[model samples]
Target: MSLEQSSIRDAAIKAPGRRSPAANAPSLESLVSTARALVPRLRERGQQTEIERRVSEETNQLFHRAGFFRLMQPARYGGYEYGFTALLDVISEIGRGCTSSAWACSLGTIHQWLLGLFPAQAQDDVWGKNPRAIMCGSYSPITAAEAVDGGYLIRGKWRFASNVDNSPWAVLGVQLPEENGAGFLLAPRCDWSIEDDWHVAGQAGTGSKTVVIDKPTFVPGHRKLTFAEAASGAPPGAAVNPNPLYSIPFLSAIPVCLVAPLLGTAQGAIDAFVELCENRVTRGGIGGAGARLGQFAHVQSRLADAAAAVDAARLVLDRDITDVELTAAQGRRVSVETRIRNRRGHAYAAKLSHSAVQALFSCVGGSSLALDQPVQRMWRDANAIAQHITLNWDAVSTMVGQHMLGLEPKGAY
Candidate 1:
């Protein structure tokens, strides 16, 4: 028998039977409200969170108890089976508290959806024993691997694994030998180690560090998925989990996760700016004594503009989220055109969010620049998220333009 078949047989014997979510799965409204409630506490912990260079254990536990990680998890395993739009609502609200915390939550939550796209056996292997398990991933395929009898021997370092400190497993991208492309492997905690190299000026609490597989580790075949298979919009998981959400093209909506936190980050900046303007008084300037900052026409205009930009950003994101969900619901594949448009929307929304925060940051005085000030932290974290390659305006716009201009796009979809 093939090693892969043998591995499958072993897993089948150990894997538990499927089950459905509890009768009282969280409603979308309840999840959003729960996220909103986390804000005040998350706000209280924001500065110390960054200083600690990772989300505190208490915050993670709160998310666990609130069912945030199960937002996009499979219903068969007690996940709410909520879609991306639900993710948008909950994660953006969380961002209003702390960008780093929101980011950690975003990655943790979205990866559940991504994992649901994997084959059934793989999903069972990860979640069957621990329904609450959440994983971190590094999707770049720069690591090394060799095809073996059962699966492959993988060994290398993958970087930018967000929320790694809090996750017990990793989805590491690997380039299969002699293949034209790369794929992903599901590795447990025993297969890899974390490198504490996450020091940064922004989004520090995400703890996005490197994961090193110090030795050639044997990964079972059922736990592997190639990028080609994922992009095909007919991922193996679609058969086991008949939800259309799983059938949506990988790149079409997955990038949405990268920008979702920024939506809340910008809104959070807007909130802080409003609060700052309401009570801040101009002091000791030549002609500006005892003036309420909010009274100035120019300051008012900045606030209005920031609000409009952030509002527009949410509309754009929601539009695409709706489009993809509806398309998937109707049992149609997300077309290439829609995919490119969604890509543009993701990058554009990110641009709007970054610009909004930048405007508010410029208007806020030096006092806001202090390490603990919410607006400053929001600005820093927004800038950091905008730097993500998927959200880089120039790169995504150029790729979209190329597709529109009738040339094959050169970038990752």
Candidate 2:
């Protein structure tokens, strides 16, 4: 047998029990409220977060104190069993003030939810010792795993691992060749090494790097989760977590969380643009820039439209999250149509946010184009977020149309 297979065998042999500590936890609603209240402070630190190429240590500590990471963690540990809506609200609020900070926090916090979907033993190894410890992840199946006695030996490199600088653990996507077909696996952070390769134009502080796993690392049977299991709506954590929220389809919830931060970023842009408009003076013109800015029908129209777009997007997000939460509470599977529609809503929001930023920037005139201007930063961040595959207009719009017309959806919906 190969070294990969050997590692798999070792992992299977060392299956460990799931771990949990009965500690007091904060409520998810309260966490959202606190996050909203912190937006002004986060906005003040936005430049600092960008300069550090990661969220400021102070901001991170603040979020941790607010229990932002425990929104989706299993209640058996010190976590509130809230669904996707609360997370959406928190991310949106943060993004509204500082896009990059919001993105980092959102990425760092949501990994806890994903971790809860792993096998109990895998969850134990991560949260058993420190429930507050966070995990960062990337779900690209760039690596391969070979099955052996108790588990599989995994080897591959996953790119775009966000917030890895702050995380002690990671979960990655791997593919294993099987007799019947191929199996997609979710494995723990211990099996891989992180590569510092994050370089990007906007949201530079996200620290989205490459996670490298050379040769093979052992992942025990209990620690492995397959795409088939996820598709069946029977994740390994089901027996232990016993929460319907954990049972929701992975595709539906994952993308929603991934893109929600952009909504917050768009809000931040609007706020900044409005503030600039209020103080800016038109140079070498008959009327002052502020007076013209306020008086122009075009400016008023654009602001109204942008505000409406952001609000509409928020409504869609709220509605979709409510569906997920209600369905989970009722102990029923969320329909594919609902998931597809939710994806559509998310994509639409992203598109609208980009447009809103563009509209606001256009009204700000040439002076706002300076790199130092907050409006310019918001514009750049909004465009960057729009480029994400999950927010791809073509894919999401097409998927929703296909589902609506009684056609099968493609990709991870």
Candidate 3:
């Protein structure tokens, strides 16, 4: 390692979650409760959020001003330095009201934690000028990076760069196979352009449009972290950040960010459907218009099953988060066994949430096909979440199952 890199990794300081935020900064409870309070307003805006095919700028400003984006940001950067637990609580509540808004906010907060894994120079390049600057990324390795003097020259198109409209920087996946590495290269906003082409049947509000870097762009060496380094549980950023949260293995816990929204949206859909049951009635059949939907034994059964599924999913997620936090606090490397186990938990929780949303959406009868209903939108968003590569059940399940059976598991964690 270069002297500069060694010095960067050796100098450390003390900072913990207990360290209070800047005077008057919102507390963890305040952030979460604020999220709960925003539910009604988000619900009111859900249809419009969907119609716009992106999170409205008004809603984005609400999060920024509320400090919702600082949940996992490093304390030194004028942030709250809260935990994954805090992240889960806040994002899920937002998801309960509107999946798109919740999703956009979730990525925004989690990436702060992710960026804290980079070298200090990279962190400074981003937050020094504007601490509130947010980052979006596309981690599907479709790009080529040619080695250059200072760092690399990259040119490619990346898709599903979520919340690009709100981000000033992006970290894209690049292959460095010659070095046996898979890298995330950070690009300034000026280096890339957005393509407004995120139209989809579900998750229309995510605005996960394409990010294009048609011309070669130079990325400094500091603005990169390979997947291997991220999984180390002690990347370069750990030296400076000093928070135990930075010690946790990357893949072991970050998936929680992706799944928490699913859990919240499922719970929210359940809430919506239960209210619908209280007044909804059958029509044009033997039961006639007077038949109360809630009184039907089949409907009751579906509701019960779905509620149980959601609860089980939450328990799994909570258990894994606790394990990750404990491991980090103890300053121990998360075992391969634990990493795969957490991977299983993340994927299984998503499966359960998606299943629950489908059941409730089905219970709505013709309402299932209706776009105006929140339950239908929740179902669609849940499906979209399930489709994400990081949350894919078939792949994750098989990989974990292989490890459980004493076989060679491959890809992801």
Q: Backbone clashes per model, in order?
A: 0, 6, 0
> What is residue 339's positional error in candidate 1, in angstroms?
0.2
Question: How much is the lDDT of residue 376 in candidate 3?
Answer: 87
Segments of candidate 1 deviating more than 4 angstroms: 1-23
- Candidate 1, residues 231-305: lDDT per residue as tens digits? 888899988888788888888888878888899999988888888988799883577779888887888888888
lDDT of 3 by residue, 70-152 (tens): 77788888877777767777888889999988998998888999999999999999999999999988888777788888898
Q: Which ten residues in a row have the lowest lDDT in candidate 1?
A: 11-20
Residues 291-374 of candidate 2 have per-residue lDDT tens digits of 646567888888888898787676666666666656766777888777777788778878987888888888878888776677
**Residue pairs in clash, model 3:** none
* Residue 338 CA displacement from its true place in model 2, Å: 1.5
Q: Which candidate achieves the best lDDT against the true structure? A: 1
All candidates: TM-score: 0.93, 0.88, 0.93
Give candidate 1's error at residue 129 in angstroms. 0.8
Candidate 3: list runs displaced more than 4 Å.
Answer: 1-25
C-alpha lDDT score of every prediction, in listed order: 0.85, 0.73, 0.84
What lDDT does model 3 reach?
0.84
lDDT ranking from best candidate downward: 1, 3, 2
